[model samples]
Every structure is written in C-alpha cells, then in structure tokens.
Target chain A: MSSPSGVLATGSAGDTRPAPVVSIRGVSKRFATTGDDVVALTDVDLAVAPGEFVCLIGPSGCGKSTLLNLVGGLLPPTAGRVEIGGRPVTGPPSEVGMMFQKPVLLEWRTVRENVLLPVEARNGRKGAKAARGRADELLGRVGLGEFEERYPNELSGGMQQRAAICRMLIGDPDVLLLDEPFGALDELTRERLNLELAKIVSGTDKAALLVTHNIIEGVFLSDRVVVMSARPGRIVDVVDVPLPRPRCLEVVTTPEFTALVARVRELLELGHDDDGKDGDR
Target chain B: MTAPADQRHEVPAPAAPPPDTRVAWGERPSIWVRIPTWISLSGFILVLFALWYLLSSLELVSPFILPDPMDVVAELGNMANAIGTGGLLAEALGITVLESILAFAAAVVLGLGFGFLVAESDFGRIVLMPLLVAVNAAPKIVFAPIFIAALGFGISSKVALGAFIAFFPLLVDTAAGLASVDRDKATLFRSLRISRRKTFFKLQLPSALPFIFAGLKTASVLAVIGVVVGEFIGGGGGLGQQTKIAGDLLATDRVYAYGIVLAVFGYLFYAVVAYAERKIVFWQTPHGVQAGG
Candidate 1:
C-alpha cells in the first residue's frame, strides 16, 4: 500500500520526523450508568503528524466526539492515554485551541470582543490588546471586518461560524480541534465553508483534527481520513486523500475524490452493521 | 428597468398607502401624544383634588374625617416649620432612611451569598431550598412583633424587620437568575474546559443580573413597608408613629400631611431602585423603557 501523501510530504522534506504532534494510545472511554457501563470507545489508537489536517468520520453515537474530547484533554480516556506534543493529557492545554459546533459567541460582547476572549481568558489586557490587531486581520481574512461591532445575534449562521473560527485561531495555538464546526449549516453553506476551512488550514501552521459525518467534506478537506466504527468506536480504516494541494469546490466533482468518498462510505456501512451485533456488548 | 409613469399608474395602488408619508405628515400630532398623556395624568390628579375640595367645602365630608386639600397643605407648611425647629417628622424620616439603608445592604449581601451557594451545589439546593420556600411562604408580618419583642423597640428591630422582608426577593431572584443560564452555553463552557468558578463569573452572573435587579426592585418596596409596620406595631419614632399620634389627636390634616410624606418616601425609594436597575443593566435599557411606558 502506498504511504499517505501527508507522510510522504514530510519525508520528502529530507527530515524523518521523530514524533507526531498528537498521539492516542489504545484509548477507550466507558461511561457509568445505572447497573451498566456504556462503552463509548474501545482501543482507539491514532496519531496525527505536525501541521496535518486529519478528519474523523463516523455515524451518530459512534464516539467520534468522545475521541476528539479525549485528545483535547476535556475528558480522560477510560483505558489508555492521550498525549499532545509528548505531554500526557491532563487538563486543557493553552497550546491547543478548540471550537464547537455552535458559534458559542458571548452574546453580551461584540464580534471583535468575542474573538479576543481566549486571549483575554488565557492572557490579560496587554495580551488581548496585542492580539486585537491579529483578530481584526483574521476577521478581514474571513470576510467579517465590517461586522466587528455587530452582536452575535445580528450575524447570520455562516458569519457566526466564521467569527468562531477566527476566535479559535486568535490565540495562535499550535493545534486546533474542531468538533463538527459546520455541522449545523445548510448543505450549500457547509460546502462553501469547507473550501474556506481548507484555505485557512493550508495557510496556517496549526495541526487541525476535524470530526465530521459528511464523507465528501472529509475527503475534500483532510490529508488523512480516519473512519470510525459505531459505539465503542475504534478506527476501522485510515484513507489517504490523494487530491492535489489547494483544493476547491471543483475538486468534489472529480473521480478521484468520489472514489475516496465511496471507500469511506463503505467502511462506515460495514461499521454500522457490526455495531448492530455489538449493541449488547 | 424603469417603468413608464403610465404603466406605474396601471399597477393597482395598495388599498392603504404605506404609513411613511402619513407619519411624516402627522408628526406634529405624534409630538402632541406626550402632551395629552401629561394632561390626562394631571387631569386625574386635579379631579381627585377637586372632589376632595368640593366635598370638604360642602360639609358633605366631616373635617375630622377627610380634611380639605388646602387644610392638609397648610398643615404640611406648619409641620415643615416645626421640622425646621426640631420636630418629630424630620427626625423620624432620617431614622427610617438610615434603618432602611442598613437593612437593604445586609439583605443584599446575605441573599446573594446564599443564592450563589444554593445555585452552585446540589446538596445546598436540596437541603436549604425547601426550608427557604417554607419561610418565605410564612406571613412575615408576624415577625415584626416577634422582632420588636426580642430586639426591643429600637433601630435594630426596624432594621431586622426590613432586612427580613427584603431578603426573600433577593434570594428567589438570585436563584432564578443563576438558573436561567442557557444549557447550550453551559455545554459550550464544559467543552472549553472552563473551570466552574470562571463559568459562574463569566457566564452565569451577567446573565442573571436583570432578574436579580427585578428582585431588588420588589424588595425596595417591601423594605419600606417593613419599616412602617415595625414602627406601627412597636412604639418607635417614625412616620408611622407620627401618623398614629395624628390619628389619636383627631388632627385629620396632620394625618393627611404625614400620609403624603410617606407616599413621597415610598416613591423616592422606588425611583432610586429603578434608576439603579437602569444604570447597572444598561444592556436591557431599551427593552425596559419600552415595557415601562
């Protein structure tokens, strides 16, 4: 089997990398309920290279989000360990920035203020003021420069998400974790944001792990797509997206992209069928 | 893409033209709305004064029963002179104001602390909330006599009554306000790995400010009532005591004067609370003004 282009790209740079930015080692999460233990994930091991765009795709209740939270140190693994930059996952690391499915903008603050929240929370006024220029720059990059003074309620769904993305990037984190950040948008808007996200990820040095259910979006935006099984989720397949660099909407219509989407879809279908038998386990 | 004037005319006109033109034409009358509102308000006051004056003049109302407005005004003037010369009315008002202020401060601090505690912990909520509801449901007026008997007829008794009356609203409103935080926002904070204390300050407190102020507004009015009740039940120096003296002497005009002073005092307390609510929660100013008028 051919190695992933992402690995090859790093290999061709003439430096054999020593360690991945994030590594999940035999991680499993089980939640306790009345008289039963609900296994959410089981023996999930994955590694993401530095600056790589990795996408996790699975059906609902498949523990994709659980895994994302585990990697982010929001939740501890029940069985194994999750590490970031060679550090054992403890609490939230300032080096890792996170964004949720919703915009999660503080309604009381303006757009500019919302984008500067992490900077203010992690740092003080001096850091926030220093980050302000960068916040405005990101907003302009995301086409929201004119809306800095507007409240979150006044902005449309897509604009709010754009602001959220700017917020995620404002802290200048080395790693970005997005849990279905565009899952709430319409199909048209999601496709548009997929392209925007691809451009943003390519432009930054941050390693991003995106959890999504959209197969096409997974193929279009990721360097490597990790397909997950249903509840008690584990990696079923890891497909390398061979699409060329600087992808756009037109890439979705290509045969190579469609074949990759089909392969991921097959893995998900098989995972779903296996999940049916494992329901009682 | 401009249509000819003839074709524009051919397009049927709306049954009612848009109000833009009418609003501009009738701008003068819109300004007059405030004048009529003020006039109607003053007119109602004038009607009340007229009835009082006419009934008292015609002897249909006994002077000992309902004194004339003129008589009340004259009494008020005389009392103002007496207040200038170290009379009970001014001294009583000063004592009442001091008592109410102390009680209000204590109520706010204690109520906020307890509210936050009950809201943050499940055990506190389960253990204390039911007991609090029982205490709140009890007739707090009974506590006035009990407090006067226990604490004696001094500033402490009145302050205790006022604080007791004021505390319930602060507790209820604070709990309600903290509880009113959006669940989605809480989940967002959880995913961010924000600490519980930070979440309370950053998310819960601001969101609950409006409700807490609503409680305080209600409590201000209750605080005034509590002080007056304390004065009435216990024999202390306040407007209520002066009112009692006027009632015993059958000097109806002096009673009316004291009643007016009490009304003004209540209105001022309410106005101060309303003003504070406006300034502190300015984010809700637009909505408050719209709803108030």
Candidate 2:
C-alpha cells in the first residue's frame, strides 16, 4: 500500500484553494495549579482541509484531547487562535459536533431520542419530524435500526457508542471532533468500530479529528497521523498513510501496515524519552 | 449404559401431577377474605355496644364521671337533630373545614415560594433560614393567644394559627427536595450547554416533586391540629367550642360525641392529602418499585 513516490493523494490541489475547514495557529494552553502552572499544549500549528481525516496520537497526559476540545471551541486557548471554516472560534460552533470518551447519552431518553437531542436543542419542534427521520436513517447506518426504542442502559457498550456517533451526525455538522470515542471498548469491539467508522466518515463530507493513543488505529483510519509529544504537547511529526482507500481488517495484516505501526511506535517511545529528560531537569 | 437405560424404563413414572390443579392466587384477593374483614370490624363494634349495655344496666359508674357509651350515642342522635333545629353542629363543622382548607392553601403557597427561593438563591438561604428556624422553634400555642388578641376570637384567628403551624414542614421539605437534585445530572446538562432555565424546569423540578409532596402531607395534618388548638384557646364556633360547652354543663356524653367527630375530621383530612399525594406523584410509586423490585 506504500506510495512509490512517497505521497498520498490529498484531494486535488485546485480544491485546496478554499480555506481549510479548521486552522490552529501557534495555539498553547496553560492551566494554573495550586503552586505551579501546568503547560498542556504549546505552539501547535495545524490545518485540516475540508473532508480531511486527521488522527492525533500521543501518550497519556500528552494533551491530544485538549487540542480536540480547542478545535471544538469547548475551551479558549490561553495563547493562540483556533478558526473553523475561516471564522475564529469564540464558542462552540453550531456546525461542529463532538463525541466524548463516554457516550453521554441521557439515561431517560431512548436511543432515537438521544440522537434527536442536538436537533431539538438547535431547531426546536419545527424541524422535529425531519430530525426524527434523519435519526432513524443514521441509526440504521450505524447498525442499530431495531434498537431505536431501547434505552442506553439496555444496550451493550459498543451499541451505546454507536448511538452516540449517530447523535453526533444528527446535526449534520461540517466538523466532527472525536475524543477517544472507542478507547473504552475491548480489542475486538474497538477494531469492529474502527472499520465501521471509516465507512461512516468516508460517506459524509464532514472533516473528522480523532484523538487516540492506539498507534495501529491511527494508521488504519486517518489520512494523516499527527504524532504529539508529552506534556506541553506539540506535534512532532505528521505521517501520511499511503494505504489504499476503502481499507478493511485484512489491511492491518499487511507488511506495509506493520511498518507504519512500527514507525508510530518509535515516535511514541521517543516522546516518552524526551519527557523523562524533562522530568530530570 | 445398558443397565442405566433399563433402570430408567423400570422406574415407575409418577402420576401426571394431579393435572397441575393448584391455581395462582388471583390478581386480587377474593371477596370472601374482604367479607370477613368487614364482619370482624362489625363484631368489634358489637363488643363495644355490649360493654356499654352491661355497664349502663349495672349502673357501674357515676353518670357524671363516666357517661354510658349508649348515652354518647344518644347524644350523637340529638346532635343530628340539633343540626335540623339550629344547624349548630353542621355550622361548626363547616367553619372548621373552611378554616382548615384556607390555612392549608396559604401554608402551601407561602411555604413552597419561600422554600424554592431559599433553595435556589444562596443569599436568601443564608438570611432566611435562621429566621425560619426561630419561628419554627417558638411555641405555636403562644401564637394562638396572640392571634386571638390581634385578630379577635373569630375564624381568622383559627386560620392564622393553622397557617403558622403548618408552614415549617412545607418549607423544610420543599427546600430539601429542591436541594436534593443529583449533581451528576447537573453536570450532564452543563456539558450539553443546556440553558439554565431548561435545566431547572426539566430536570430539577420533576426530581423534586416527591419530596415536596411529602412535606405537603405533613403540613396538612399539622394544619388540622393548628385549627383545633386555636379554637380551644378562643373561638365562637366549631368542635372545640362544643367541647367547652359540654365541659361547662358537665355533659360528658356530649363531650365524647364531639371528640369522636373531631377524630373523624382529622382522619378524613389526612386521607385526602395522602390521596392527592398519590395522584400527583404517581410516577415515583411505580419508578421506585421498578428500581428496587
């Protein structure tokens, strides 16, 4: 699956004239503690083109999740700017959807109702019927058509996550931020969901930024994998996956996939060694 | 394996379990059990009547000290007749009911308003909570006399006393209910960026209903007691007035009859409040069962 010329097609160059869907310029986040200030992210400059799939991978406490939240406009940057669709993000954009590590489904609401929550919050009752129909279609796409009437508690962990994914799409947002969306599931479940998510994202025009600690997952799913360093996290390298499109589970067993995984693993270990040196200082 | 198979065939099969004759207890208990309950209650009444008859027949006690139960029953008959003559008993009962109802309404409105205000606003809670404690701690009987001195010996005094006595529970319970919303639920709303008004109405209020209703039940009973105590202190009419009249004339039988009427009124008032609580908080009843069962 390696590109002989060492470049993956990043859509046509002509289509890149429009401003990137999200642009982060020299952004840093610092949090005050009892006695010292903690730096989470530092001088992170990144841009996501329209319909791009980017995965941020790092160790625990590396602030990859913080970067995702910044782009979602859930937090204000202490030092830099984050723009979405060419507009500076002062607050959560109506066109940006977020899915947290947990499903965050309202326990009192059914699966279908949970999916419809965003639409109801944004549009009220006027668009409720259309929202319901869209929610049903999304649920079907996520392989949960028969479980729409069931409550979150009645669903398995994987199914609950699927419902949450449907909810994220219900608003028809242009940008989707996923914070370790499959990090809680077992190995088999996470693998199955990764395949399903690839298909789902490929079918939509939304630009997705996934935060994960899994190296294989980053290679298997993202168009470009952004490897980040430890605390005061900054992007260390951007590795473009040259694997062919329409990837399946079989792709993970190939020699090309193993080499990409090895490269990410070395970068992550290098991030850890750098952190070790900083701790000593 | 051959021996085991032969033994299985040799074993005598049990009879067909009597065609599973036993049936489940019906969805509800049978009428026969209910009939006996009624009959046993009537038997209790008969026993009381026989005791009354035996005591009166033997003249076992002084008439002034222990009026025969039959005499009280007869007084009740006369009381019914007095209802037609001047409608005295009915009028007193009407006034008592009216006073109780008015006091209950006033207590509920004021208590719920103050409770929610205190629960919702930190400043209001800090300032008003101490004042409420002071008011609740004072002897309500003192308020009864003061109410009479200020409002005069009329229905207003009784109503005031009832309202005063009933407000504390309503305030306490309503505040507790409002304060008891789950913090996790609040965080969920915050994460969603739900509006504050929507959070209060949809999440907090519905969750607080059971606690508020509990306070109402306690306040209703207190309201009845308040009215009776107020009447006992100074009142122109009601069962308390009749008690004073019977005491003055040394009509013990008539006094007992009034006491019985007061007991029935108290029971009825409590029952009505309980019934309303069940109706308004019906979701709690079924939801609790599903959670714990």
DockQ of every candidate structure: 0.10, 0.06
Candidate that would win on TM-score: 1
Looking at model 1, the pairs that clash are none
Clashing pairs in 2: none
Task: List the TM values for chain B, per candidate.
Answer: 0.83, 0.78
Candidate whose lDDT is highest: 1
For residues B40-71, write the lDDT of model 2, one tens digit per residue: 78888899888877886688977776788888
For model 1 chain B, give the 10-residue run with minimal summed lDDT. Answer: B3-12
Q: Runs in model 2 with CA error above 4 Å?
A: A1-19, A32-40, A55-65, A101-114, A143-163, A180-198, A211-221, A224-281, B1-104, B119-122, B129-195, B207-293
Which candidate comes out best when scored by DockQ?
1
lDDT of 1 by residue, A1-281 (tens): 22332432221234354457777777899989897888889988777777789998887777888888888777778998777877878877777888888888877778898898888777766888888889999988877777787777667777888889998888777888988899898776676666777777896667899999789888889988988887667778788886889875677777898899999999888888755333222
**Per-prediction backbone clash count:** 0, 0
